[model samples]
Target: MILHTTEVTPLSGYRLLLRFNNGAAGEVDLSNELDGEVFEPLRDPVLFATASQHPVMRTAAWSNGADLAPEFLLDLMRVQQGDRAA
Candidate 1:
């Protein structure tokens, strides 16, 4: 099944609370993932708080055009939740 982000809420320390279309919801910390040119800008708390669910992509995105795939986010969420199989 293809996963798609249905909602996203930015939290402190570069974390995000996400809800997927499949009924899975959790918080994923992205503090360590902010690297490279595209993700660099999100290092700033202000910009990071701009995270929202993209209309078309159906994934987390920021005004700077930076976005993460839903599948990636779901995997990270699972890992953070201690689902080693993720």
Candidate 2:
């Protein structure tokens, strides 16, 4: 099944509250994932707060053109929630 992000709210400590098309929602911390150029800009709190659901991609995106796949986000969320099967 294809998963699409429905909403995204940025939180402190580089975390995000995300809702998916499958009716799953959770907070995922991305503090350790901001490494490469695309994600590095998100280290800035202001930019990180710019996270939102991309109109076309239907996934979390920032003004810097950085976007994460909904599937990846869901997997991350599951992992954070201790769902090892993810």
Candidate 3:
């Protein structure tokens, strides 16, 4: 089944606590992902903390337009917990 992001809370150091539609949630560190022009603005902790769920429900993004796909976020959670994605 496809999943969607229900909530997003920005954590310290470019990390985010994301809750999904399926009741799955986790912390995602995006410090390394902030390299390109679009993502560069998010490198600032303050700017990164502006993350919010988009109306489409598929992901979360910052004011500068840097966003993460919910599927990718879920996969990261699966890998971190050693649980395979269904």
Which one is best on lDDT?
A: 1
Full ranking by TM-score: 1, 2, 3
| Count of residue pairs whose backbone atoms collide, per candidate | 0, 0, 0
lDDT score for candidate 3 against the true structure: 0.80
* Model 3 Cα shift for residue 58 (angstroms): 3.8
Whole-model Cα lDDT of every candidate shown, in order = 0.91, 0.90, 0.80
Q: List the residue pairs that clash in candidate 3.
A: none
The TM-score of candidate 1 is 0.93
RMSD of each predicted structure: 2.1, 2.1, 2.4
lDDT string, candidate 2, 1-86, tens digits: 67898889999999999998888888999998899989999999999999999999899999999999988888888888897322
Runs in model 1 lying further than 4 Å from the true structure: 84-86
lDDT of 2: 0.90
Error of 3 at 60 (Å): 0.9
Candidate 1 lDDT over residue span 18-43, tens digit each: 99988889899999899999999999
Candidate 3, residues 1-86: lDDT per residue as tens digits? 78899888888978888888898877877777788888888877789889988887568888887787898888876776676433
Greater lDDT among 1 and 2 belongs to 1
Off by more than 4 A, model 3: 84-86
